[model samples]
Target: MLRNWQEVLDLLAIIVKIPAALIMKVEPPHIKVCLSSHSHGNPYEEHEMAALGTGLYCETVMATRAPLLVPDALADPHWRNNPDVKLGMISHLGLPLVWPDQNIFGTICVLDGRENHYSPPFLQLIQQFRGIVERVLKQIYYDEVRVHEEAAIRADDAKRVRLEFAAIRDREQKALQAIKESKQRWHFALEGAGDGVWDWDMARNTVFYSKRCLELPGFPEHKSLVDFAEWERCPHPDDAATVLAEVQACLDGCIPAFANEHRVQAGGGWKWLLTRGMVVGRDDAGRPLRMTGTYSDPQAGRSRLAGTERPPGRTGRHADGGIAARHGTDRRHGKDGLAGPPGGRCGPRIEHAGGQYHPVIVEPEGSHRGYLRARRRQAADGQRAGRIPAQRQGRL
Candidate 1:
């Protein structure tokens, strides 16, 4: 746009046959030559400053918001001392430029070395050129305003999106942590119960077994159990069909619960297991979605049926599936058949050694008083059951 304005100034110089023509920019206390005509003998240069002196043509035009014309500076006493006269420009014509808001911008002016009157047509032409420059300035201002508005809107949207994504990520992390904690709690509870727990996803025909459940069937300790068929193979051949029938009855909603006594292969031959389960979850149409159960190895005293004397490393079972020594001697070598402290489920077991029945407390070392009290209580219970010797009765 400035290039086009410069071309207009050059054409003005050619049309008016002037030595100099300029487009000036009003900068408060001074006016600067923004563009100068390319005509020969033009004294003013582009970007040169002209002071706001009393008699300069551009300054007077801008002060009045009107045009200024002087046919000859020497002939007019008011303009005789003007700067243009000292520079050999004796004639001048200029029109004031204004913004759309009517603020003064500057002037478009022509200077000549000779005295000459500018025609009316030339004056009108300069006014039209001034209008074009004002319109260009207005368009540029509006374009910059639009660009700034769009940039502000984009920045606001980006900030909102970032906040939303951060919120979602925070929620996901919290949910994952909660799931991890829940799994740990469930595993702890199941292991503490000392029962072999199992879960069956009926819809997928998959089964899950806990560590205790795996040990009951004498399978190696593992974290996961996938194949239901493999679990079916653990039951003794004689009891498998009946157990399956009972479980199927419960799954079909024919029984209140799945309850069955079965034998499963164990570390010490087949051990009797009392298995119980129920449908814990159901689909919308009443089909069982999931089933959970427990395994109880009820053969604690079954070894007594083989003989009156129990072998070493073999745990003895009582009439009610509890552990007790009938041979006046009991010993345990591993994690099995041991309970710790009063808060734990497994109580102390009695061991007869060196002519006396000593109570074995499964707590940490250094519990002599508890052991003595347990022994006294065991002696009383055994004497009532007629299992203790009369000579040892005074030991209580």
Candidate 2:
């Protein structure tokens, strides 16, 4: 485009019979020859510059936003000392180029080496080219604005996408944190209640046991079972079949849940436990996907039934106290010589003596039924003798 403007300057210089034809561009403090005619004897060179405010020909045209004609610089006192004299181009005729918004671009002009008045035809030619230059400036300005607008639109789209991804990530993190906290709360609650919690993943065939669950079976706190089969190994042989059947029934949707009192091997003996569980998740085909449950020592109820209290100074003992008391001995000869199965289902004798009700262990030689019958007869005899209250007789 600049080469084409050079050609235009060359043609104008030839047509006007001038030594120089130039396009001057303003750059604040100075104006430079942006293009110069290639004609012979044209002293001005492309990129030649002169400081503004120095009485230059182009400066006057730009300042007044109008044409400038200097017919004879040496003859005019106001123009004789201008910088163009050093180049020996004293005759000047120029027109200002302006943008569509009327801002000055610069001047397109012809300069001669001798005194000569520029003709009307020459002036008309300079004016026509000035209009062409201003049109090109307008087009360049609008093109740059369009490029900047497109860049800004792209930047906004990128910013929106980044913000959307950030929002999604933040939401996911919050949801995961909530799930973790919920599990912690459930774990603390179950452990506080003295229950051993368990979770079975049917698809993975894996069983996860809580710390209490491991402790219940005399396993190390850090011990981990690999699968449900390993957990099944903990149940007593006699109870394993029944326990598995009850669990399968729940999994098969035959029962709402599995609740069974069974024995599990712990230490060197067996401890009776009440295990309750239900299928918590299932597939569309009704097959169990996950099961959760808890195991609790059932001996606490038996201890209460026998009117026993937790022994003083025995902190952290199981609520039952029976498991610890019967640990290294036969259940028949357990604490206080309690005669019963390992579960403590029966054989502890309750008697109202010394003004308080308490349990007394009966010898295994006596049948449970015979002992109850003899106690009833003794209670009736006491009532007849006025030794027992009528209200207490019913309790006996």
Candidate 3:
């Protein structure tokens, strides 16, 4: 931990009793002193640079990738002309510093003014210090690499979270938009039809009546009806049983639709209502979940045909594919449909047949004068045959 390069060099200078000790770093075509000793008469300074290819001790050690020793540079012919000898540094010894990849880093070396020989202990001490410097360089490299890798991982995670959040937000927006559009369409349909609408939640036995529905029965628009029992009370007593029975048949799956003509008590008098509805929702068990329907008044059109009539014995279909003569033909009978007595009310009645209710609008009757005269003659013949008394014959 106490591996400061200058401190190591200073301690080395004292232990070896040398005038100069340093760590030099190699830059292409030049070498610089990175750390220098603080010993007295030490001529070298830290960060000093000199050209390579010169006869400098550190440069030669780096070039050879081995240790260099000159006990007395002035006396050795090979080192006699070395630049350091002219500067009064005649003794030199150094070991080359190599990186992990075998590239030369520089040299750790010492110089002396007097002639000296570096012993084994002095050489080993400098080698151990070199190992410490290399370890520090390796640690620095590893820490820098790890910092970059962790930063990249954090950036990737942030990007993924942003994408997922955007996708979820898009889906939520689309769902809300769809619900808004559906509600708008529903309201538009209700406004245009002008029919009294009702929704019944069959599972809860609760009903929700629209403003039109409440108004149709001469009730205030602000009144809320939540119970089916209350709705049952609104219909005329004579028609309530028939209406409920038809509705029940639909709920029980015996009929495809609930359709019936009934009367309800209004503010003025009884109002005829043509009620049509069907089960709109179902559960997994095939039970009814919800039902919806509309209330319409057919009297507006029926009033237009008040005085219409048909010719005698002329039975044919109306434009609506049912008998046109309402006063005479009873479709419940076979062909050659029996005509009711003249002036009798003969509107189609709602009846359950073949698992559903159907309307059979009948043809109107002939002239009342002809039908009544024929009826009286038939009663006289019955009295003459003694099948009826004279008093009963008079009533007929």
- How do all models score by TM-score? 0.45, 0.58, 0.41
Tens digits of per-residue lDDT, candidate 3, 125-211, equal: 888988888787667656877898888888888888899889989988898898879855764586356567788875676777776
Clashing pairs for predicted structure model 1, backbone only: 300-317, 301-317
lDDT of 1 by residue, 1-396 (tens): 888998898899999888898888888677899899999998888889866765677878888887888999999998999988988999998888777567777888889999989999998998889889888877876787789999988899899999999999999999999987986687678667656778887556678988878876667766356766666666554344345544555666666576555566676576666677777888787766788888766554342221122235333322232122233323322223332233211123223355322333333232323334445667878743222222111111
- Among the numbered candidates, top lDDT falls to 2
All predictions: root-mean-square deviation over Cα? 19.6, 17.5, 16.6
Instruction: Quote the RMSD, in angstroms, for model 2.
Output: 17.5
Off by over 4 Å in 1: 26-31, 49-64, 70-86, 99-105, 173-396
lDDT of 2 by residue, 1-396 (tens): 787788888898888788899998998898988998998898888998788888898888998988988999999999999889888988998889887777788889889999879889877877888878887899998888889999899899899999999999999999999988998888889888878889988667778889888876567765554576677676554344345545655665667776666566777666667787888998776667888998887655332212232233321112233222325432223334434333322223223354332333333323333334444677878743222211111121
Model 1 weakest lDDT span, ten residues long: 387-396
lDDT per prediction? Answer: 0.67, 0.69, 0.66
Please identify which of the two predictions, 1 or 3, would achieve the higher lDDT against the true structure.
Answer: 1
